[model samples]
Target: MKTLLRTLLIPALALITLGAIYFLSAFLGMIIPVGPEKEEYPKEVEIFVHTNGLHADFVLPTTHEVHDWKDVLEGKHFGEFETPYLSIGWGEKNFYLNTPTMADLTAPTLVKALFLPSTSAMHVDYMYGKPREGDHASSIWISEQMYLELVDYILGTFELEDGKAILIDHDGYYDYDQFYRAKGKYHAFWTCNNWTNRGLKKIGLRNSLWTPMDWGVFYYLEK
Candidate 1:
């Protein structure tokens, strides 16, 4: 019994230590600016970053002067209602499909997500109006050129076929939203928040050094 206890103790302590290190790193990364200071552009376009306590989504106006999302995402998927904005997010396929709410989450789903190179999907939520302040959302003003470049970066993250998004047939929990196949594998290190961070970095926004949680993305924005 003592021998068995000794064997179990080492692995248990190792896991606890690792957990502490991960959380510490995430906290410090949020407070520290990893990249250069955010740049300001002469011309500004409003974009939103939203969080649902756990995940982050980028919200952009549907029709920008440079690119109209309707050119790609049609009104049909959004119940034929021409929304003014779209909220987009990316996550593990299994988590996205199986766990629309916290109640739907399970240990197996989390285990597979953290341990395996899982498939990914993108979530699209159409909105009739712009996101308001105090909506747990942060708004950034970027130049039209930067916004256009960010648009290209975003669309590129979708796994497209013949210049079209690969639609995933699963129904979203909300009526105004849908899912599509996405590029990259979702794992413990490279998470949905990390994807958002990278997207912000691509557009020369202030972002965390390394973050796996939603708060990390918002921390820099709030500051």
Candidate 2:
């Protein structure tokens, strides 16, 4: 009986030792280099551009005033207008950001509209003097020339469709029924909100992360 027990224990101990050796071998394989491989690093894509080519780090705020697109067009101080703004809250309803045609916008802060005047330095075919594609949610205007340049720049700088940028030309002012239709594209829509959101995220901001900031209110005329 003692001999039978010794034989069983001996076999079990040998099996366990072999299993431990196999596990260590696999672990060591992960740490030791056995073949040629390339090291990778995080990639960053630039979204905003200053005339002088200085990039303002796109940082998001914890809370901000919601924009009234019509009021902004009517010359209201829609927060900071010189640099674009971005937000991440999902909207429950559609909001107005631009009109189909050009109209005289009159508001107390009407002077702010000078930055995006239609008949001055830049022809305002759409609000901000940009071309409008006939969608309320896509309330953006850019020089047909600038738009093309931006498209090329975005495509060349990053792997857009899936990598860095998505198209923002669908449904309401927030996520809505038509939102997905604008997916897998770039730079058709132009809102300060959209621009800043894309800018911050492109610079490595995840949806739920809180980052440090310095807040200031500055007013400048648009050229």
Candidate 3:
């Protein structure tokens, strides 16, 4: 009786404690400001930030005056998806590869994702057309320099070998997408949504001061 009670009580208390810390940190982090005091550069590139209500992705044009991703995100690497825009997202390796949907998530996977700083992967989805502004998507325009800065930050995240992204041999959630090994570890402090926010911050765009949630990143976007 005592052993059983201890086991249950300890995990329950730990969960409660972690939950409190997460929310409290998020609230404070979002409030604290980062980035330029004002956006002065002319908006030259239009990009999309997309969320499935949970994870966020940085959606950029496949080919643009600023940069061309044709050779990098080649169609031959994945199924044909030579669309106008490509959506890139980062997440824990096990979670991204194993859990295709929320329903597929398991207790061990969730626990490992939140607490463990494990391997990460980049999920690239090629879009057929420009995403219309809707509940799940939002568009923002930034300067050419800012866009280039974003390019550097994002492209740098990939675990490139021989000056190229190492393709992972796995099917995407959709036929038009593929996965690549990425730099960095996914854990409590830096999540997929947080990666979007960080990129926005790097480009002097509007973003949450800090966020682990997708909604927070979109919520702080320019109205």
Poorly placed runs, candidate 2 (over 4 Å): 34-223
Whole-model lDDT per candidate: 0.85, 0.26, 0.85
Candidate 1 structure quality by residue, lDDT tens digits, 127-157: 8887776647998888888898888988988
**Residue ranges of candidate 1 with Cα displaced over 4 Å:** 36-38
- Residues 1-223, candidate 3: write the lDDT tens digits: 9999999999999989989998999988886777655657787899999987778998999888979876566446334434788899998989999888999999999989999998999998888877778888898888888889999999899988776778898988876788999999999899998998999998877667889988778776745
Which regions in candidate 3 have their CA more than 4 angstroms from the true location? 1-7, 77-81
Output the better candidate (1/2) by lDDT: 1
Tens digit of per-residue lDDT, candidate 2, span 106-183: 442233321232211100011222222121112323233333343443234222343333323433322211111111
After TM-score superposition, the amount by which residue 6's alpha carbon in candidate 3 deviates from its true location, in angstroms, is 5.0
Kindly indicate the candidate among 1 and 2 with the higher TM-score.
1
What count of clashes does model 3 give? Answer: 0
Ten contiguous residues with the weakest lDDT in model 1: 72-81
Candidate 2 local accuracy as lDDT? 0.26
TM-score list, all predictions: 0.92, 0.18, 0.92
